[model samples]
Target: MVAQLMRSELPVLIEHFHLPTLPIDPDDVAFILCADNGKATHLVSYDNHLLELDDRYQFRICRTVEFLQDPRVSQAR
Candidate 1:
């Protein structure tokens, strides 16, 4: 995956964020946006910033407490 990510030109964008480079590849912002558009899975986030993306991404803006009590999460176990 590191090789693939390197080839995808993601390292440059990651560097722009001033984040330290790591061995493992992190998911790209564009990929996350595409995933939301495709309705691939639930986008779980407690951050207020995620609310701004809700309209565009069709993501569920859940609180930390609500996420913890969601039955689907428990069922996966």
Candidate 2:
């Protein structure tokens, strides 16, 4: 699956950011975090470690349920 994905035009997940500092080794955490930071948007995740990055990154971190319902969330179009 990874090889097939790499061969496509879609961005490979791990290439999204520098992952050397990740705490739990889950690529999803880094992927979502970097995307939000790059876009200046909120990060919605179930991971507790990720939720703790709000103060450091100037972005909101919320559970997926809360993020989807927040009035501030705007689709990127």
Candidate 3:
């Protein structure tokens, strides 16, 4: 899967990003920043802190299952 992703055009490799100070966990900030910088429609994760920030960010935060079940995600495939 890693090799496939590396060769695919679907991924955007973020080389430089300005880290923002958020109220959430330090380790999770990178994930949020990546999603935000990538202009993602959905931020998928099982972390409770991220899930709780669902309506706060530019992107929609959801669980892995919820993301998989989203109609938009399926339509994008």
Overall lDDT per candidate, in order of appearance:
0.51, 0.62, 0.79
lDDT top scorer: 3
In the range 1-77, model 1's lDDT, one tens digit per residue, is 88888889874554443222221334445444555556643556654555435445444446667656778767876
lDDT tens readout by residue for model 3, 4-72: 887885855545446433636767878888898899999988889888888887778998888889899
Q: Is candidate 2 or candidate 3 better by lDDT?
A: 3
Per-prediction TM-score? 0.35, 0.45, 0.66
Q: How close is candidate 3 to the true structure, as a TM-score?
A: 0.66
Which candidate, 1 or 2, has the higher TM-score?
A: 2
Q: How much is 36 displaced in model 2, in angstroms?
A: 4.9
The true-versus-predicted C-alpha distance at residue 72 of model 3, in Å, is 0.8
Stretch of 10 with least lDDT, candidate 2: 14-23
Clash totals for all candidate models: 0, 0, 0
Error of 2 at 8 (Å): 20
In candidate 1, stretches whose alpha carbon ends up further than 4 angstroms from where it belongs are 1-10, 14-31, 67-77
